[model samples]
Target chain A: MERGGRFHTKSAELLAQVTWEVAGLPDPEEERKRQAAEFAALAAQYHPHPPLARNLIFAFLVGGSICAIGQLFIALFQSLGMTDVQASARASITLLALGSLLTGLGVYDEIGRVGGAGAAIPITGFANSIVSPAMEYRTEGLVFGFAARLFSIAGPVVTFGILAAMASALIRFLVTG
Target chain B: MVTGNAIAIRQASKRLGHQTMRFETAPAVVASASVVGLREGQGPLGRYFETILEDERYGERCWEQAESRILKEAVNTALGLAGWKEDELDALISGDLLNQISASNFASRNTQMPFLGIFSACATIAEGLLLAATLLEAGVAARVIAAASSHHEAAERQFRYPNEFGAQRPMTAQWTATAAGAIALGLPADGGGGAGWGAAADGSTGEAQLLPRITFATVGKVVEMGQKDPYDMGTAEVPAAWDTLLAHFRETGRDPAYYDLILTGDLARIGSEIFREGMRRRGLDVSSRHMDCGVLLYRPEQDVHAGGSGAGCAASVLASYILKEMRKGRFRRVLFVGTGSLHNPVSIQQGEPIPTIAHAVAIEA
Candidate 1:
């Protein structure tokens, strides 16, 4: 059977074919898909596209500043006689704490609103993803609410990270052997 | 189940055509009250709300509890304004944007009145009003209350991310209003007083023509145009609103000029524009007389994106601004089209397209 037709024409035909319809008729699924496509085309005209250039500039500045702050913490820790790796680890921990603190104080979301992906792509964003849900679900109780939901948003990241690491280890072992 | 008395007293058919129902004995909206959180209280319609809550939690322990408390407060305030006690009310119909509509259930539990819980997402207020008006006209009840509510924090947690979660919303996204509204409807007092049970303080009938009455209602069908973007619900809901509006116009033999104003529930910016374009395509121009509660609730500087939404968007606006203006003779006839996107978080996650519904209720003074 012929399956392609404009939505208006198909709909008009469908309306006319409302009787009995035990015989030849256009496929309902095809009609639905056409109608959906038609409506989507119309609706797309009214949907406003986000300003990508402005968001990119904001993200670059804000994300660069966060990294600069991380570098500052690393330098400070190294000045306290810590090794390079130890200083880097300590800086990460400090940033995580800062993210959690700002999230608790209800300020990180404001930064996110202005910074867009800049606030959402850093180590601080990871902390926010975990802490925000924990605080939101605290009213449900500690066991099921706080603990269970603590990683609800960040669980995929951890799970996929471990899986990717294992896969890479297997690939290295196979290649080395 | 049709007894002899049931058949004998059954008035002429109230069903006007396919979708519209004409209430022979129109129910009077006796009283209404709006209670909103600080954000909505600071919006454009702030001055019209009955109570502006300084605290979003309303001194409650949790956000869910706060939602229930606001709903209860709205119901109580409406009852108080109507001068009716709890026992005097016949039934309460209420809903909210929550899992299982727990807000309305908990609020009804506190009221201790016969309750019927309903859910139509944002269109719940109009659904409740239609049911309440039907109960009054059916001779089943004398007085009924219809209410709906939504909380920004509570709905955000359920439908999207946590309130404090850092994420940028798209321009098409609408902010769920933290508000609640309740309205009391009852049979008009005898002698065409136009005042409901408690309105005639001195037993004077001078305000006989002032009361706004629910005269017609059109129940909408679920219309799915396969729109799947959950963040862009304003566009998703336009087709349903258009369907119901067309059905109402066809069934009642009325045009856009029949009513002084046409109010849509929460179609916000894009949806309202699309609706107007669709109507114009059909040779009906409702641009001048049409307004959306979502657009009216907030100012552009409020940064609500598309605008205010949720069950409370329509309910709060209707209970406060629209009815108040109607009472002041600003509009004599109004058509309220409450639009709702019926997709849940689970449905959206399942990759199902969004389906929408709209219910239109006609009110006249």
Candidate 2:
């Protein structure tokens, strides 16, 4: 398959110190550049053009709506006489529960489909990732199916999150000291 | 007793039109059954399917196992409807979307018949039908069954991402159909001589003659047009579909107007448009008769972005809607082009271009 390359023969082995070199040396860098350009042209035709403006509007609206709902919950909690921190915590919990519930009921999937990253960038979307897998694997059983798959997507996030929190707390303590 | 089979068995003739095969004896689809999950059962052609599970699980351990179980049920239903016992089948050709086609293997294992495991990715149903017809044409098999299946969650987990990953699917991404379909092919029972099997043996004779027959098939070549995006599969597969359709027309000396309908399997909306445009460029306008199984499988409001896709997407739709409509005299001649993206997750990860193939089967009433 190597075109123009010299082939080694039985008779050539006896011709010691007389090397039969290839006709032309192939340049790796040059070949790579050519291939890259070819791929780029093909991709330009094959790859779908992103609708940046429309997507931006969708993301802004959906993300803004989710945050607005969260703020509403916070305001309601505060009106009920809870402290600011407690109200904020309660509002986040409510949003997470609603996200998981909607996901389990198959509504969040539709929302995520059209909302795109707008729906996915919020705290509820995180809850969706955790709940969606669990709901899908529910047929496997409660412990093995649901519980096992529940963390398949969120486990790494939790792992790094705790580690980062610990490091940040240590730095804060050292700086204060 | 002689089984009312055909009087003369022709020799194994090769090369029909171009890459097409003309069976000496067209194999008749005696019985067929389509089984789908809850989501698919709610689609437009839901009532046409033989079995619709209220629950997606169907009493299995996982989505994969559920897929296998439904496939087995579909095959069993087809056999039962044909009034043929398990031992009557000479061979079972089957496939699924799972690795090694385990769902089909599992389904076939239950029958204990001679099984052929085929994998054309999503085009497996068409591939199986062509091979089954070839067996009948060669006079090697009296009765044969071909089936294929897929589960949405199972296919997603294996091909793209885990359902729980909360991965945002692009608009171009398609939904994998959770369904199974089985078709039975056999010699004409009412042939002049009592040389073949018929209704007296199984009590399904009344419905035998109405079944659509497999008349021809064209095997497609693998075409790679340097497409790499896994999400946008339509652009990758449309070229292969167009190539095969052109080949079928060229080899058969026919035009797009020859068929009542020309359907492509699981191209969805995006691929369907590309296929139509490609055909138009080739001087064959098929927009009037052209339809896609992917786009037909779901409602727009269902939020299936590109449309439905999978081995089951074509298999179930053909077995239920197309065959039933043909039986009702809605279509006289139809061409089904089954398109498959023969790429694995590893291939996509390695940045290899997706290679695609499409097989066409001509079914006539």
The candidates' DockQ values read 0.68, 0.23
Give the Å error, residue A133, model 1: 0.9
- TM-score for chain A, candidates 1 onward in order: 0.84, 0.78
Error of 2 at B268 (Å): 1.7
lDDT of 2 at B204: 35
lDDT of 2 by residue, B1-365 (tens): 42333212222344555489887577888777889988899999897888889877787768888999999998888787666788878998999989999998888775658899999877889999999998998899988889999998899878875565446677688889999989888886723112222332233345533558889899999977767878877667887898899999998888999999998997888788767876887899999999988898889878777888899989999988887777656887999999999999999989999899999999988
Supply candidate 2's per-residue lDDT for B78: 79
Query: Cα deviation in Å at residue A19, candidate 2?
Result: 24
True contacts kept of 2: 0.29
Q: Alpha-carbon error at B363 in model 2, in Å? A: 2.0
For candidate 1, report its TM-score. 0.91
Best by TM-score: 1
Per-residue lDDT of model 1, residues B1-365, tens digit only = 86776554444558766688899899988888889999999998898887899999889988999999999989988887777889988999999999999999999884558999999989999999999999999899998999999999999999999889989999999999999999899887722222242242222334433678999999999999999988988899998998999999999999999999999989999888888998888788999999999999999999899998999989999998898777767889999999999999999999999999999999998
**Per-residue alpha-carbon lDDT of candidate 2 for residues A11-92, written as tens digits (9 for 90 to 100):** 4553432332243544544554575455445434533556678878888898899999999999999999999999999999
| Candidate 1 CAPRI-style tier | medium
